[model samples]
Target: MVLPISRFWYKFSLFLACLLVFWAGFYPEWVEKYYAQAFYPHWSRTLRFLLGNIPFSLGDLVYGLALLLLFWAIGRMGRDWGRMGFRSASWLWLGKILHALLWVYLLFSLCWGLLYVRPSLGTRWQLKPVAYQKEDIRRLTLSLLDSTRKYRQRLGTEAVWRPCRDSLVPWTLSAYAPLALAQRTPALDQASLKPSLFGAVGDWVGYTGYFNPFTGEGQYRADLPFVLQPFVALHETAHQLGYAPEDEASWVAYTAALNHPSDRVRYSAHLELLGYALAEEFLLYGQEGSFAAFDSIAKENKARMDPGVRADRKRIRDFFLSRQNQVSPAMNALYDQYLKLNRQEKGLRSYHAVLSWALAHQN
Candidate 1:
């Protein structure tokens, strides 16, 4: 009787949560003013305070335990089906599953997901949007290429790269100082970026970094190319700061990385942004139906880059190519759908929107 009463309340809670989620979609300003600005920072800071200093990921451990519990529950359900029969047991298990899902959604929303509905970082920053021509893209690409060349020249040899990787979290934390919105400082005591427990498997899944919303921890694959690590750390940290969209997070990371004290960090930003600018430039040519011109210009751009920068680019390309797997495409497609469901209209292609943001900020 007590168990049944408890289940009834859980179901009621789930219904209320569903209504709240729907309501949140329609009232982003209320969500932003109340949840993002007022509620999120406090609880997020508390979660980080409790879990951030731990050397290993408490969040990952919890996830592993949850997976095991799910398997055990599935086996239990199979046995219950055979013994008690479907009519007797199925609804009970269904209620249990729904109860679990309700909690997951509530936890996700409370921790970080509600930020998805907030005004975009561009709007928050009040960056004026401008109509950019192909010439603007070409010029931006060349300028980024120049910066990358200069920064790569500043960063010599693999030895310098190692210390830069080691210092990424601190450098990124300092970089966020100027970018903070009101009451939204990302630099927290003990809230250090961590290496992902999944490690090399992340290469197969095609993610360099992710934020554990449950723990308020930013995590990166430890085995990523040294040149790319700083930007990944910064990107994941942006998520920790409640910039939920990939493009917004990428843009935040780009801005922070460029302002980072170390040239290596700035080089990583310029290198990645250069890739985006080049992609935009290529798209512009394709829109004009001049694939031939794009090809010639791309070759020229590569040839003009510093030799060390070109080698680093090759290293990054070779790293991903070598790790390419069948699972990555399926995982990417699923993530694309997830992004679309969360209001990113372009899905995986939204990451490229950073170039447009950059262009707007430049103007």
Candidate 2:
């Protein structure tokens, strides 16, 4: 009888959610005006200040409690099996689960999901779609690769810029600030980036970072190599700024990183772009083009990577291949479906869209 009342609200919420999602999808500019400009900026900043001082991720604790509650529910269900009767108790749990699912979707929508309908990074930057030739991509890849070598050498030689576990968060936010200003996105600085408590686990799932819609917190996998931190952090920060599409966020991060002043930060960003460009080239023009782009790096410059830097790069690369058991295929599948339902037709592959947008911006 109590569950019936809860189910009533769930039905109402689902109906309203359907209407809102349809309207948001139909007229995104209205979402920008009625939602983004009117509320999110102030709301996110207040969230940032309240949560920033704690110096650790509150979202992590929330998830931990959620898991505990789930297990508790399961145990209770087992105990109640005879008392409540099988069908009655099973019906109760299923209803509660559906109600919970609806509420999570609603919360996600109001908090950060509307951002999925926002204009793309290319639109914000006024980048015209150019018919990119292989020559264009090759040239851009070559230029970035050269710049990457220079900055890698410059940063590597300076022992002071060496990776410190404690300085990671501060350095990431600092690199993000100028890019925010450059892009005229004031909301970018509203929330500080958070380190994932479950970072070691994240590496196995191939997630470098993610945003918590419920908390408006940006979180990066802390277990990542130092060389890979800035790019991942800034990319997550892009989500905090209300870019919902994964690729668009990556583009924003790359844009900011490319303009970053610090040699270490700039090199990290350039290295990320170099990888993206090379991948696109390989897909579009095959291995010959990728090899050509790779060979463009000066031999002397390639040899200049410090032993520590080389190790950092290797650690980042190996995270995907080395850890299999910890990854959750079911969770990944659900997330993939979520992305497709939102705005990304390519689903998980949308993250790579950063490369083309970034290259176009460079030109």
lDDT (tens digit, per residue) of candidate 2 on 106-137: 77888888888866656667876456777677
Q: What is the TM-score of candidate 1?
A: 0.91
State each model's CA lDDT, in order.
0.80, 0.71
TM-score to native of every candidate shown = 0.91, 0.83
lDDT of model 2, residue 147: 75
- The number of clashing residue pairs in model 1 is 0
Residue 179 error, candidate 1, Å: 2.8
Whose lDDT is greatest here? 1
After superposing candidate 1, which stretches have Cα over 4 Å from the reference? 1-6, 84-92, 129-133, 163-165, 181-190
Error of 2 at 333 (Å): 3.8
Give stretches of model 2 more than 4 Å off: 1-18, 79-86, 129-135, 157-161, 165-173, 179-183, 187-190, 287-312, 326-331
